[model samples]
Every structure is written in structure tokens, then in C-alpha cells.
Target chain A: MPSRDEIFEKVKTTLVDALGLDEDEVNGSSRLKADLGAESIDFLDIVFRLEKNFGIKIPRNELFPESLFTADSGFAENGRVTDKGIAELRTRLPHADKDTIEALAKDPRIENVEDLFTVNMVVNFLTAKLNG
Target chain B: MRWFWIDRFTEFKSGSHATAIKNVTLAEEHLHDHLPGFPVMPASLMLEGMAQTGGILLGESNQFAHIVILAKVPKMTFHSWACPGDSLLYSAKLIQQSDEGGMVEVKAHVGERLVAEGEIVFAHVDDAANGGAKIDQKNFVFQILRNVMDVGKAGNGTGA
Candidate 1:
């Protein structure tokens, strides 16, 4: 299995190719959407690239479940994620920064949930996926 | 002008690849209006031909059960120009496919000289379940290329 840094480098290269980002622009903390300016369609392209690069099969909805973030999912109330939502997100995004998710819950504006999808989050996800 | 860009499919393999040819003609009205004297076949139209070649391949993979639209163009590059009297051959290969969408890597060539190369993204819409509301269910793409597809089928040894 590749080391976490090795995996991160591959992930970073994939993001740079997929999203047309400069290498310096991406890092452990950069957000996929907010910081890196990835649109929803780019998610599909990124997943494809990841699968090809890692030779892994990722089933639909395994990562970046955009539908879950919608207001109608009962995951959030008044655009803020509720405790129930946070719990659900914990279950859903096990590889994400749990502390960040928890911290955001204290000031959980619904949009902030999207912030959990930073560069490190993907590296973490791949680390677990490959090591396991 | 007729939205159908490619004249016909020269080669087609279900769920894999397809090659279609378009014969650029000086008689095409757009060429007359596009610059009047130097009637070069626009790269944009050649890109459409590439998409059509790939789109039909994708749509037929699912038997055209869903509405497939050219959803995105992530990469495209033109290396040479195609002009009147030139035959543009568009070859498309399926790169990836999932339930919701598929991607194809396509190239447009004028007899060994590469004109353009790119990747295309297509989305499958289950109109009935997704509430497309007022989408044309007949699929304009299939409607236009129906005859050409028949020709391809006949040439494929279907004999009908």
C-alpha cells in the first residue's frame, strides 16, 4: 500500500488534471468545491480519474453524496445541520475530519457542511480505502 | 442548416466505438456566409459530428432507453483545419460509463492528418422518472440519424 503522502500526491495530481488547478493551489486544506472551484459535474470526472488511477471501483454515492446535502433530506433544519444530521454525516463521511464536522456543528450553517470536502478529506478517504 | 453534422456512420461497434464520416462541401450555405471566399469547415461543427458519433454509440448501448444529451466537453484541441471537399472522419471510443452518464474520447481526422481531438461527457435522463416535464421523447438525434443507423445496420450484415 502507498503511504498517505504518496496517495496525497496522486490525489493532488488527479485534481490538477481534472479541475485544471495549479499544483500549488491544492493542499491538505483546500476545499474541493469552495477552494478549488469544482462544480458538481466535475465530481463525476474526478471519480472516474480516481478509479482509473487507483484501479479501485467506487460505487455510486460512496463519496461526495451531493443529494444528502439538500434541504429536503431532513438532514438540516433552517439550513443548519442538526445533531441528527451531524450524526448521519459521521456515518456517511467516516474518512472526513470528524473534529471539523463536529466543530462545524457548533456553528453548522448548512453550506459549511460542504467544507468538509477538502483535499485532505480525499487523501484520508483514499488512505483508508487502499490500506484496507 | 440541418443539425445533422455527419453524413453517415462508416463503422460502428456497439458499446465500444464508432466512426462516422462527413463530406464538407462548398455548397453548404454556412460556408458562404462564414467568410464568403475561404470556406473552411468550422471546427465547432466537426466537434458536433464527433459528439453525434459518440452519442449514438452511447444511446444504443442502453438501446436508447434513456435520454442521452451531450452534457459537457472537458477537453478539445484542433491541430489542423478541415476545408471544403475534405472528408472528416470522426472516431469515438468509450472511455467510461456509469448509470447516470458516460464519457468518450473522440478524434476528428482528415485522412491521417489529425484535425481535432477531445473528450465528451453525456448524461442519461430517465425522463419519465426524473420529471423532464416537456422533453421531446422521440430524441431528435435518433430521429435525424435513424436512416444512417439503418444503413449501418444493413452494412453490419442484418440484411434488412
Candidate 2:
């Protein structure tokens, strides 16, 4: 099994190669949108890279916050998710529920791109698949 | 036949890399029939644009040794929607190259926002051997692509 740092580096390289970004822009905290200026198409590129690099299949809906991640039940409005914000998404899986997603999104522990919970989910999934 | 999109080759370096552009407009006939109220360029067509770009690169690079046909799209993902009046810039770089086949990484964008991305794989085939006959370069395939794309020019008489 590869170390966490090794996996992280591989993911970062995939991002850089796919997005045509410089080394400085790819870091632990770089947000796909805000920090790296990744547009929608770029997001897809990242997903493609992730899938190819890790050899894992991430559902299309799982990639977007609007599709799967949501806030609390009471916080939801008219079947819409309200923002309590996610605190730390590291523990939450890509298919996790609204409250869990909210906690992770609000969590400061996910400060950079490397800190995203989805990456961990992907890594774990890939590791398990490869090991078995 | 009118091409759904048209782009100019801004940068072309023999076989290593290439860049092109596609202008989307409401005037396109496909848009009218694609969706009634919501008209957006089809993702498959966007991929075709990438393929064309990569194909030209491969043809030029290999000196037209084999006609490059898009064999497989391992993965493709779209992040945003592209509508009328959007100019998509496509750039492709050769990743792996050989006598028989190659792969290129391609990305499309509107302004600074990325719209779609995928890796295109191409297989090299002899025009006469595969098609069971010899083919002309200018008046055959390149001419057709030029006519469809309305680019009006061929790439150094190589894309037969």
C-alpha cells in the first residue's frame, strides 16, 4: 500500500497535468474552483484523472455538492438543502447524507484540495479494490 | 453540408501539439433540433472536435503514415453546459506515440472555464489496405473535412 503522502502527490500531479496548471497552484488547500480556477469542464477533467489514476469509478452525481451532499433535514427548504455548511468532510464518503456532508463541508479540517473528504473516499475505495 | 462548428488552427507544430476553436451559435441547425427550449451543444460532438484536432496532430506528426480513427474514449466528463454564442477553445497534446497508434490529452473551454475533457485514442490504418482501395488526400478526406468544417484549407496535403 502506498503512503497517504504518496497518494496525495499522485493526485496532485494528475490535477496539474489535466488542468494545465502550474505547480504552485496545486497544493493541499487549493479549492478546485476558487484556488485553481477550475471551471465545470475542468472539474470533469479532474474526475477523469481521479478515475484513471486510482482505477475507481466515481458516480457522476457524486462529483457535485448539489446532487448528493445536503444539510440537515430541518435546514432543508422545499426539498432543497439549506447550508449549515460542512465542517470536516474527511470521514464522510462521497455518497454520504446531508448532515454528514454539511459537517464535513463546514469543518476547517478540509482546508485545501488535499483535505477534501472525497479524495479520501476515493483513495480508500481504490486501496480496498486493489488490495483485494 | 454545413459543419456544426468551425475553428482556426492558431498553433500547429508538425506532430507534437495543436490548438483549435469552435464557435457555437443559435444559427446552427443541430441546436434547433437537439432540445426544444434548452439548446446546448452535444457532448459527443464536442468530443468529435477534440478528435479532429488530435487527428490532425497525429496525421501531421506521423506524416500521414496511417489514417487515425478514434478507437476508444476511456472516459469523458462535462463540468458545465455550453450554449449558443459560446466559443470553445480546444487544445490537445500528444501523450504516447508509436508507428501504429497514439493517445492525446484534450481539453475544451469557454473563456477561462473548462467545459469538457477526455483522452482520445487513435489507431493507424493504411488507406488502401483497410478501405480496400487507394484514396486521394486533397479531394477525398481532407477536402470533405474542410468542406464540412468550412476551414477552406487543408493541413499540408497530409490528411488524405
The 10-residue segment with the lowest total lDDT in model 2 chain A:
A108-117
Tens-place lDDT per residue, model 2, A63-120, is: 4433233333333444433343232233334333344354544542323222243434
Q: Which prediction has the highest lDDT against the true structure?
A: 1
Please name the candidate that would achieve the greatest DockQ relative to the true structure: 1
Question: Which DockQ-derived CAPRI band holds candidate 2?
Answer: incorrect
Candidate 2 deviant stretches above 4 angstroms: A1-132, B2-5, B127-143, B146-160
DockQ of predictions, in order shown: 0.48, 0.02
The TM-score of predicted model 2 comes to: 0.49
Predicted complex 1: CAPRI docking category: acceptable
Q: Quantify all predictions' global Cα lDDT against the true fold.
A: 0.85, 0.63
* Tens-digit per-residue lDDT, A9-88, candidate 1: 99999999888888999989998989999988888888877887898977787878777756567888887888888888
List, residue by residue over B68-142, the lDDT tens digit for candidate 2. 667656557889878998998888888665554667889899999999887876666566434467655544343
Error of 1 at B7 (Å): 1.6
What local lDDT score does residue A39 receive in model 1, on the 0 to 100 scale? 85
